[model samples]
Target: MTELNFPALGRQPTGCPPARGVLVCWLAADGSQVHVGDRLAEVRVADDRFGRRIGWVSALATGTLWHQVRAGEVLTAGAVVGLID
Candidate 1:
């Protein structure tokens, strides 16, 4: 099985702190088949400098998707949002 991790999108070269985000929604339903580069979920990231922004989480592997986190769940970088099997 492969894990789908929330990316560290808010990291900056200026040494800005890592930001947390909420799992806005999943683009594909649970158990749906996915391929690499497919947009899997939308996230609402709250960065201190950038304020709020939308970010996309993509599938890292091609397989059946299983969501481990629900919508509105707080997420950090490297958090496992789902599994591919």
Candidate 2:
């Protein structure tokens, strides 16, 4: 299995994630099929100096999307968002 981490949306050049974010939506639903590097979900963020206000959760391995965090869920740094198998 491969673990999907939440995007470093609020990570700045200073090496800090200043703001928390929410999981806005999933591009691919749980139990759905995905390939390597597929978009699994979108995260609505609160800053841009670090990255896009909307960050993406990407699949790292080809497998079935499973145990994805729900939309509107608050995420912090290093949060494991999804798993593929």
Candidate 3:
């Protein structure tokens, strides 16, 4: 398993949830082959009263996209939401 992990959300100067967000959408389809630097999915984090924070998870290595996360699913920091190959 490639094991795609969640990336850190914003600077988050304070040591808060490293990657707290909801899996909004998937740019690449499950089981689809992806290249390096390809956008995997979009995550939305309800940071504060200002607005929701958005982040993108990208593929680190060229391989097949095997998503371990689902749309609208809320996840925490450092969570392994997917895998490659």
Candidate 4:
């Protein structure tokens, strides 16, 4: 079992494609140990053009980063940001 984090809400960097209204940022460097309730990523939410924070990304279970992800990237449910080793 692996865990993924939600991207934090904030300004979108210039040149980077706007996250489909959502983004995910990993806490660990691609591959790392993850524990329950561990902060994995930050999720950004927007309300009528005004960006707001939804919440912090947490790990569902202990696991490892299976795939590498970059900042300011949109993430969908079960996107497989990483896999537990």
Specify the highest-TM-score model's number: 1
Could you tell me how far off, in angstroms, the CA of residue 18 lies in candidate 3 after the best superposition? 4.5
Q: Whole-model lDDT, candidate 3?
A: 0.81
Give the RMSD in angstroms, all C-alphas superposed, for model 1. 1.9
Q: Residue 40 lDDT in model 3? A: 92
Better of 1 and 3 by lDDT: 1
Q: Model 3 misses residue 62 by how many Å?
A: 0.6
Off by over 4 Å in 4: 3-19, 49-51, 76-78
Each prediction's TM-score versus the true structure: 0.88, 0.80, 0.83, 0.57
lDDT of 4 by residue, 1-85 (tens): 6445444345566685544435445566666777877767666666446645565667677766555566676664345455566
> 1-85 in candidate 1: lDDT tens per residue?
9998887775655665556789999999999999999999998887777888898889889999999999999988789999999
Give the higher-lDDT candidate: 3 or 4: 3
Question: What is the Cα-based lDDT of residue 35 in candidate 1?
Answer: 98
Error of 4 at 76 (Å): 4.5
Over the stretch 1-85, how does candidate 2's per-residue lDDT look in tens digits? Answer: 9989877664456766456788888889788999997878888777755454877888899988896578889987568888999
Candidate 2 off by > 4 Å = 13-18, 48-52
**Candidate-wise lDDT, in order:** 0.88, 0.79, 0.81, 0.58
- Candidate 1, superposed: residue stretches over 4 Å from native: 12-17
**Count of clashes in candidate 3:** 0
Candidate 3 per-residue lDDT, tens place, 1-85, comes to: 5778776665665755464778899999998999988989998877665468888888988988898879888888678888888
Clashing pairs in 1: none
